[model samples]
Target: MQNGTVSMAELLNSSSALIFMGTGCSSAVPNAMCLIQPSDPPCSVCSQSLSIPPDLNPNYRGNTSLLIDHLQSNGEHSYILIDVGKTFREAALRWFTFHKIPRVDSVILTHEHADAVLGLDDIRAVQPFSPTNDISPTPIYLTEDSMNSVGVKFPYLVQKKLKEGQEVRRVSQLDWRIIESHHEKPFVASGLQFFPLPVMHGEDYVSLGFLFGETSKVAYISDISRFIPSTLSVISKSGGGQLDLLIIDTLYKTGSHNTHFCFPQTLDAVKTICPKRALLVGMTHEFDHHKDNEFLTEWSKREGIPVQLARDGLRVPIDL
Candidate 1:
């Protein structure tokens, strides 16, 4: 498994980067519950999400998603997407235009939840081009259990025969590859290697985090209530125990949830992993981005590790 770790020399270009497609929880920042219901005082975060010059609005988020623009040797780009959720179309309309992303080369699913997999039907939007979609089927990597859930939820996506009568329709042409669990070996996607880190979402359900990149090792666990021992071991053992970046789940400011990391749990995990830099994601409308980020900046100084919040359209360069 530790055969060939990418060397620092390979990262001199330093052009590769990760773009946050969406950084909000399932409902997003200004969801219907918050907007339509309109609490007496009105949700401050949801209210501010519609501020003028929306590009600068951190609160306007879609479901948590990550796009890795891996720069290839021939000056080409490989776009590997992680989690196309319930708000995939909306996120795409805004982010794809803002970032000028031409296409999505591959997809990786962390779990089977609606926040992670509902966007499967929309993959056709970026397979090759907009209207034609005449390229090869995009490869999607996911665990067997998650794939089972997908098969149950999206039977036609897994098997074309299920939609035999609907062959005329141009559904998302996808290639499903059932991968093993976190304990299994690493897999390659679009020339980049990724190691799955299995984590507990709730008591019975499990989701995946991923560790990827060459010199700039980044560990991204977008949804997790707890980190498993085996997963922690892999994180510490890899790259001689030095992780460049960690993007983790921080569902709320305080209080614990059964399926996601809260503020205190996020602090604990950050202390353990001790990455050079950490960015929190999967937030609800409860957090004020500027306020929380300001607090986190001071906290990062105290902890000696730069930590902050990730918002939709935020991009961070990484050495690849």
Candidate 2:
């Protein structure tokens, strides 16, 4: 059995959780214009980082998405993707292509936001590599409301009938499965059971976090503004009252966001869950990789909790 910590290569080779992308808000790091010329008064993070070569600094990031890999007994692998945002293509090219992750077994969406579902069309790129000769569609799990939103966003893919005499265009291959976000029912996907932890996105929106695994439960909440007491109760009752790993949203260091969690809110949620280890996700350009790591190291020492900022290619093995 594996002990201590594992590397990204080892984690991807076995059953593990991989953070494919870690930026929370829409635009990715190292903004194009910022690279062209420094901000007026000089934005500390972007301006200074851009002055250095990308190969040297490497601070660019993509949208938040997680990949849960399950290694079958027969030596085959199944990959369940969580959230396919607009940056999915870029992230795939940067990470998945080199890793040889050709086909996705399933997908679980948190909500209907553009940053969470815009990459739905990009799944077509993997169709040619499907194992089955018939090219079976990948199943997607999401709430009914989210499903409706997806349908409206991609009508050509959702609707069976197209305009009369219009040729069928090659599109994303997918099967939509509506899942209830009641926090009581658990659903199976990619040969693993996932328990949904419903949380509030803001005053109006509702988003979902997930709890998975038997011996070592890993809770993933990529986007959330707040968590209700009932959700906290469910999480507290999981993994023997504490999470093994908690992946949460940290959109920014300061300021109050209406639909995303900032650093303070993320810390509050982490305090409630009290996970053994936590990784902050959904970050923006405000978070510099090297600088943030130093800050998190000090914070972790003070709080006595192992917490760090997640990067685009971070892979952590979940002990089961």
Candidate 3:
């Protein structure tokens, strides 16, 4: 690792820690949007408006990758991954290569959406070489609704037993944690405590964002319609004065999106949370990295907050 930084095992032994290995958008999109380039149809501005990494960089990837570093003095300093999207496999590979994380102790599922959970099987690639912790399952925690939905969509994990002990080896055993509906309460599973917030996702189902703590607290709430009073209350109670970090959704630009946070509103929420730094995640093709940062820098200066616009493989140091 970096100088003065402890190993994953050592960090698990200490307290007060956080790490974010990737912060791309939700799609793990390539350098630019696949459709409509600078020379394409309509006009240059139209094509330019839909790009993220700009047409100049060829190696950009869309979607966000998050790693929660929590280790408090001789305890298990494991990680809590917020969302594992369709690009999860690639995201995981990139994360390991960049951060050198040999294994991820657990994963937290935000919702059952494809961009959030489709990479569930990618864990197989990181399974302990010698099978640490008694060959137990990797331990994935999710809200009740998410677990039910995951069970339905990926039924192979819990299907009937064909052989004897074969059932024990399926993606390991999926340990289920039933979360409360209060949404503001903080609960613990595996070895960490998570502050759960209820969010509305397009009238279809209930989605959740979480604040997990191995030692430090990081609030992750993207893909929500609006942050209601209850949500704010949870923020104040869980985050208290401020947060170490906040990963929020910024799906649209400045306009009002019916089911998601527009740029200005997201900025407002950032003002409320007032974390040391806020990184925007879950972005769509509507944002252009180089151009968006110019606007974000002005906003950050006006708001007196530090904001980092995400791109694929961007590794940010979360102060330990």
Worst 10 residues of 2 by lDDT: 49-58
**How would you encode candidate 3's per-residue C-alpha lDDT over 209-267 as one tens digit per residue?**
88665335577886777765677765652445567777788776768776677788888
In Å, residue 204's CA in model 2 sits off its true spot by 0.6
Q: List runs of model 1 lying over 4 Å from the truth.
A: 1-14, 129-134, 162-167, 237-240
Q: Which candidate is the best by TM-score?
A: 1
Cα-lDDT of candidate 1: 0.85
Model with the higher lDDT, candidate 1 or 2: 1
Q: Per-residue lDDT tens digits of candidate 1, residues 1-320?
A: 13576554344234788999999999887766877788889988887755645577898878999999898777777899999999888878888887777888889999999999999999887765534435689999999998889999988677755444553456798999877666567898898899888999998988999999887888989999988988887676342486889899999898999999999999888888888889989999888889999999999989998999998999887877
lDDT of 2 by residue, 91-161 (tens): 77766765667678999999999988999999887667543224678899999999999999998768766
Best candidate per lDDT, number? Answer: 1
Model 3, C-alpha of 231: deviation from truth (Å): 1.6
Error of 1 at 190 (Å): 0.7
CA deviation > 4 Å runs, candidate 3: 1-28, 31-59, 129-134, 163-173, 214-216, 236-239
Residue 130 CA displacement from its true place in model 2, Å: 10
Estimate the TM-score of every prediction: 0.90, 0.88, 0.78
| TM-score between model 2 and native | 0.88
